[model samples]
Target: MSRSHIRHELSKLESCLRKEIGELANKHQIKLESKQSSLCEIIEVLTQAKLCDEPLFCRLTKLDAAFCQLDIGLYGLCADCENEIEPERLAWDMLEQRCAECAENYEHQHRQELRLNH
Candidate 1:
């Protein structure tokens, strides 16, 4: 796909993520002031959570970085092997820049190193 097309897709994904985060915040009642201080604390925690994208702003920021890479024609290209990621796999996850085989091999080697430490 063209650069413009990829950007357009990223925009759509950002919008969707924003909408979902908004829904999550509302569902979790993450208001500035609540009966329990824990509610506000949870919202603040969401702002920094890396594994879970509960806050709309934080999630959009991460997506923006990926879109920037896509704009530079670096997206979907493996960082390790410099190989083009398979289109079929990209269809499942556009954010995946590394090939599955490379990732598996890397993980296997990493595990062997940990085992040696013991």
Candidate 2:
């Protein structure tokens, strides 16, 4: 997908999240600090209240980070290796911008570290 397409999709995701989160909070009588909260604020509230599970929280976190990187023309670059992220990963999860090799290595490293600690 094109950068424009990814940008548009990210924007749409932000809007969708805002709308759904707002509705959920209203329905539950949750008190958000801001009536017109920011994307970060929404994330914070969602996290604080445990309104969503790990996968959704992870997705939202990735989306938020992607938006931050997009502003500086770094949206689809691998965070670990400074390479273009694989198209397959991008297609599967628009916010997963890590190249396959680096991602695999990173995961392996983390797993090894966990094993050593445990």
Candidate 3:
């Protein structure tokens, strides 16, 4: 795929993520202010919000980095192996920084580490 096309996709992803983050933040704030629930219930809500917000924030950060890389003509290349990421995967998620193989390996290692830590 062309660099222009990739840039366009990344832009769309960034816009979508920003909108989602905004909505999530707004919903969390509204829930916190309007809900009159038990402390446990409030904590549960907060925990759920945190779980959703954290990942969105992470994706936003990654999208920002991808924009920077796109500006520098480095987008679509895997961070670990420096291979061009598959077009289909890029279409699915422009923020992904690893090729399929590297991503699988990274996820495997991460899971192993999580198990060991547990």
* Candidate 2 vs candidate 3, TM-score winner: 2
The alpha-carbon lDDT assigned to residue 47 of candidate 1 equals 62
> lDDT tens digits, residues 1-118, model 3?
7778877887677666556655665866735421334324433454666653577656765776787788898888999999999988877877888999999999999999999999
- Model 3: runs farther than 4 Å from truth? 30-53
Instruction: Give one digit per residue, the lDDT tens place, for model 2 in 4-74.
Output: 88789998887776666667777768787434877788788887888667455577688889988888889
Clashing pairs in 2: none
In order of appearance, the predictions have TM-scores of 0.59, 0.73, 0.70
How far does residue 86 in candidate 3 sit from its true spot (Å)? 1.8
Q: Candidate 3 — which pairs collide? A: none
Per-residue error (Å), model 2, residue 55 = 1.7
lDDT of 2 at 26: 76
Highest TM-score against the true fold, candidate? 2
Instruction: Count clashing residue pairs in model 2.
Output: 0
